[model samples]
Structure formats: structure tokens, C-alpha cells
Target: MRVLVVEDHEELAETVAAGLRREGMAVDLALDGPTALERAEINGYDVVVLDRDLPGVHGDQVCRTLAAGGSRARVLMLTASGTVADRVAGL
Candidate 1:
């Protein structure tokens, strides 16, 4: 499967992408939300591993844009926030 990993944490993003790659999935990394949107437009990714608190554009906004744009990729949201609202919003 092709996956896009969007995270502001460079080290964490690369680590996750490397692990996914080793598992045989094609993975791409986007260090922030705007870059994530750009890549998403250019690629037909099967999945998007998105960080909720991203730079440029918020991850929630990115997710909304993808859904609104009729993307078929599944979004898996990541966040360090402990709020119930944050979790619900991502879902």
C-alpha cells in the first residue's frame, strides 16, 4: 500500500516511514500540513498518517480538505493532545 506520513516532528516521521517501508509499503513523508496537501494532490495514496497539530495548515483542516476533495485514502490521525475534543475531531 502507498502511505503518506504527515508530521512536524522530522525524526518521528522518518522513523515511522522507514518502518512502514521495511514492511513493504511505499511511504512518503511530509514534514508539515501544506506539504502534505501538495503531495496528496500529486499522488494517489492509499492511506494518510496525519499528525493533528501540524504547521502551515492544521491537520484537521488538511483532513477536511482531503475528504472534501473526494480522496479515497483513509486518514489515521496522530496527536499528543489529551483532550476528548481533539480525539473526537480527528475521527
Candidate 2:
């Protein structure tokens, strides 16, 4: 499966991508929201492992844009926040 790992945390992003790659999945990395969007446009991904907080653009906006643009990839949202609102907002 093709996966896109979007995260502003460099180490975390690389770590996640490496793990996915080890699982025999095709993986790509995006460090911020705009880059994520661009990569998603240029590549057809089966899943998007998206960080809920991102630079360049917000993750919520990124998700909305992807949906509005008809991207069929399923989004697996992640966040560092433990707040109820943040968790609910991700969905």
C-alpha cells in the first residue's frame, strides 16, 4: 500500500515512515501541510497519516482541501494534544 506520512516533527516523521517501510509499504514523507497537499496531488496514496497540527497550512484545512478536491485516500489523523476538543476536531 502507498502511504503518505505528514508531520512537522522531523524525527517522528522519519521514524514513522521507516516503520511503515519496514512493513513493506510504499511510503513518502511530508514535513508540513502545503508539502503534504502537493505530494498528495502528485502521488496517489492509499492512506494519509496526517498530523493534526502542521505548518504552512493547518491540518484541518489540509483534510478539507483533500476531501473537497476528491482525494479518495483514507486519512488517519494524529495529534499530540490530549484535549477533548482537539481529539473530536480531528474527526
Candidate 3:
């Protein structure tokens, strides 16, 4: 499977990418929302591991753009916030 890891935390992103690579999945990294959108547009990703509080365009916008663009890749949003509202809003 091809996966894009969209995270602002460089170390964590690299680590996750490396682990996914080790598991035999093709992986790419994007540190911000804009870069993530660019890569997603250019690449055939099966999954997008997105960080909700991303810089540049914000994760919600990224997901919206992808959906609007008719992307087939599945998006999995990650966030530090654990509040009920945050979770509901993310959904």
C-alpha cells in the first residue's frame, strides 16, 4: 500500500515513515498541509495519515480539498486534542 504521512513533527514523521516502509508499504512525508496537498495531487496514495493541527492549510481543509477533488485515498486524521467536541468536529 502507498501511504502519505502528513506531520509537522519531523522526527515522528520520519519514524512513522520508516516503520511503515519496514512493513513493506511505500511511504511519503509532508510536513505541512500545503505540501501534503501537493504530494497527494501528484502521487497515487492508498492512505493519508494526516495531522489535524497542521501548518499552512490546516488538516480539515486538506481533507476537504481531497474530497472535493475526488481522491480515492482514505484519510486518517490525528490530533492531540481528546475533547468530545474536537473528536466530533474532526469526524
Candidate 4:
């Protein structure tokens, strides 16, 4: 699987990427929202491990934009802010 990891936290992103790599999945990392979006748009990723809160643009916006733009990759939102309202807002 080709996975795109969008995260601002370096350590967490690296850890996740390393674990995914160990699992035999190809991993790509982006530390900010714009870079994430750019990567997502340019690459054919199978899955996007997106952080809800990010610099440049939020993950939610990224998801919406990608969907609107007809991206085929599935998004798995990862966020520290866990709430019904937050999830709804993300959607």
C-alpha cells in the first residue's frame, strides 16, 4: 500500500512512517498542510493518514478539497481533538 502521512509532529510522523514501512507499505511524509496537499494531489496514494490539525491548511479542509477534486485515495483522519462536534466539523 502507498500511504501518505500528513503530520506536523516530526517524531510521531516518523514513528508512524517507520512502523508502516516495517509492515511493507510504502510511506511518504509531509510536515505541513500545503505540502501534504501538494503531495496528495501529485501522487497516487492508496491511503492518507491525515492529522486533523496542521499548519498552512487543516486536514479536514484537505480531505474535503481532495474529495471535491476527485482524488481516489482514502483518508484516515488522526486527531487529538476527539468530540462529536469536532468529527462533524471535520466531515
Best by the TM-score measure: 3
Candidate 1 TM-score, true structure as reference: 0.97
List the candidate numbers ranked by TM-score, top first: 3, 2, 1, 4
lDDT of each: 0.96, 0.95, 0.96, 0.93
Residue runs of model 1 more than 4 Å from their true location after superposition: none
TM-scores for candidates 1 onward, in order: 0.97, 0.97, 0.98, 0.95
Q: Please provide, for model 4 over 10-30, each residue's C-alpha lDDT reduced to its tens digit, 9 standing for 90 to 100.
A: 999999999999999999999
User: Sort by lDDT, best first: what order?
Assistant: 3, 1, 2, 4
Put down candidate 2 lDDT per residue, 1-91, tens digits, no spaces. 9999999999999999999999999999999999999999999999999998899999999999999999999999998899998888888
What is the C-alpha lDDT profile of model 3 across 16-70, one tens digit per residue?
A: 9999999999999999999999999999899999999999998999999999999
- Clashes by residue pair, model 4: none
Listed per model in order, the count of residue pairs whose N, CA or C atoms clash below 3 Å is 0, 0, 0, 0
